[model samples]
Target: MNKYLELALLFAFVLAETVGMWRIFSKCGRKGWLAAIPMLRRYQMGLCAGRDAEGRQLALLESGVAVGIFSCIFFKTGSVSYMVAAFLLLLLIIPYTIFSIRVYFGLCDAFGRNRFWVVPWVLCDWLCALIWGFGSDFKTAEGYPFDDEDAAPEVSGIEADLTAPGLSINITRRTAMSLFKRKVLLRDIHLIIPMGHMVLLLGGSGSGKTTFLNAVTGYEKANAVITLGDSNVYKEYNSMKYDIGFVPQQDLVRGSDTVYRTLSDAASLRLPADMKSDKRRERINEVLDTFGLTPVKSSLVDKLSGGQRKRLSIAMEYISDPTLFILDEPDSGLDGVMARALFEKLRVIANSGKIVIVITHTPDRVADLFDDVVVIAKDAKRTGRLAYYGSVYDARIFFGKKSMEEILMSVNRREEGGEGRADEFVRKYSALAAGGEV
Candidate 1:
């Protein structure tokens, strides 16, 4: 490479690394400025570790564990240079070498081949360093395994959801030995979402609400049977995927695109090929109007208010008219009026005979808005399990209306009856769940 090009290449790499990691921070609900400062990145990393995906701290621990063994071999290379080289040769060349094996696994992971790819990547990162030099293009490596993968998932099907399909999901332990670790994060539970019905799920922080949402889409695993009507969802996904719609907790919208273009492109990609541009535009306008966001139809996502942005997210998910509209914490940053308005939109969708589910915190007014509700609570350690699952109306009927002060008392203090209020809440919720009342 030319001297100037090398310098440019180095600068480009540095800039890319900086921007990529900065975007990662912003994605975690933090400002991007922290990524520019080295000390701040470390500090934020620690602060964000516990709350990040799969707890980023665990990622650090795994990387730390891998580096420990790698360092032991690396630094000792000077004193045992020949021995080190010999060992390297043996490891890389011997029968089913760990290096080659891990490299292969990393390739599998890069292409999203399997879940256990991390096992190979951590063990073989050093070997990969030797195989593909720092300056080399990883995508063009001679050992790249694209040819090994028989087929790749089609992007078209992955992003779309089919029309109203009845689903029946069943979770069973089979026996007691299966009971070991039967307590799952989300997918093991049994819930039936009939067509055209709406449900509101409530939890404080976590209650496996998110997990249950993931279960619907098959992101989370379960020994249980997830049936779409009488057909098994898992078996369908293995052979052919359903057109499911999801709006995750955060607005992962491409901030650059204007609302019009964003929805247009999304619809074009997700909708059926036979769908025309006129119908697409009409559908977009109808969705935008449904959420009272028609006025800002041309605004860039970054230019919208928090409330406007949230409405847009909901609108986008239902643009294709999905059978099930699933949203995670759609109420996350909305206020009383905005939350109420959003619920009304969900209500409209529900009344139209589509299934709508909202994961919420038992909003004072929205309680009446919900046709059904499920509550999830956590133990002292923040470990969550479903505390209740049932009909909201019945739970209210059983508990009866309490004065504002009485409600506050329950919220603020334990029971005057000498029992733990938190425990009482657990029992009340558990009873509601056991009785099939929210």
Candidate 2:
């Protein structure tokens, strides 16, 4: 072959390698820079792998050795051993491809490992690369802006509630009091979350949006009630908990299991005994596709990136088909687009007759997605009082000049102010008696 042709072939190998690497990195929720360096990327993959470090390392070493041997065989035989090496290379390549597709495309992140485990993948790839030396330009590490609607439709089962706005949620202060002792964080507050709407709860610091959801979910004990479907949820605490599927602000997935294994185990424990694996998988596929987890379906749970982990966490809650799903601070650290997509995802969930409630610090740019609006005062006592409950589309008219976050803050301040008024006056008197500043 001519020199140019050899160069082109090598370039193609590198291209495929690059694309493959991009795919993995993309799903990992990591920076693109790491995928450029092979060895370094391996270590980075380990970091994301959590406890799988040794297994991952061995896989890489074995695969590396295999690829090296494969190359040497090609140099020596010059015959049809090339095909055998190619097949071996694919043993590794196939998983990488799957990872690329699932992590980057399906799960919307790069953490998806495409096999029974990462260790095997590492070994398989090393063997393939050593033997074939095809030098195909496969690459990994890619990214796309976070998307919800555009992602594979996991459910097609859950629909967004777009009917007339009657959705409202009320989280109240005594509700806040029910959360922790000492003093209430923010008073009770109510939100009229329309049937198929995406509402953002905005607040700064101790504004209490999260606290509100806890009360709503019965995660915390409350002196008062939270209402959904116009019924006092607190009154039906045990039953209501099941009605609302929650994705907490923190990672709740137990470490030490692959994504599929963990979810499957959960299905086994939580699902009915008669559920078949195939049918269960079909539902799992819907969620995986919706959340873009199909790529790293076989990946270790600990290997997922922040974004991928977040998406996976969200996916875990919906498998049971909840009626009202509540997400606390779903957009906490996310950018605008992901936040919007989060809303879209919730919208899709709500449309299925189940209500979707998302609490955040701001509810801007998604006004059209809301069916109802509920605002709480800053005081745990006042805010938790189930203040304004109306159509979210009309929120502009109801809560004028105040953003959702600002309203939460104001209510929080009012609650704190009330508590301050109740006790601080005594504190001031004591300070004055002791000749300190009033």
lDDT of 2 by residue, 64-156 (tens): 545744463444345467666666666666654544322222221223324343343344543333222232332222433221112111111
Query: What C-alpha lDDT, on a 0 to 100 scale, does residue 295 get in candidate 2?
Result: 94
Worst 10 residues of 2 by lDDT: 147-156
Q: After superposition, how far is residue 230 of candidate 1 from its true place, in Å?
A: 4.3
lDDT of 2: 0.53
Tell me the deviation in Å of residue 423 in model 1.
8.7
130-154, model 1: which lDDT tens digit per residue? 3322332323334332223221111
How many clashes in each structure? 11, 107
Residues forming the 10-long window of minimal summed lDDT in candidate 1: 151-160
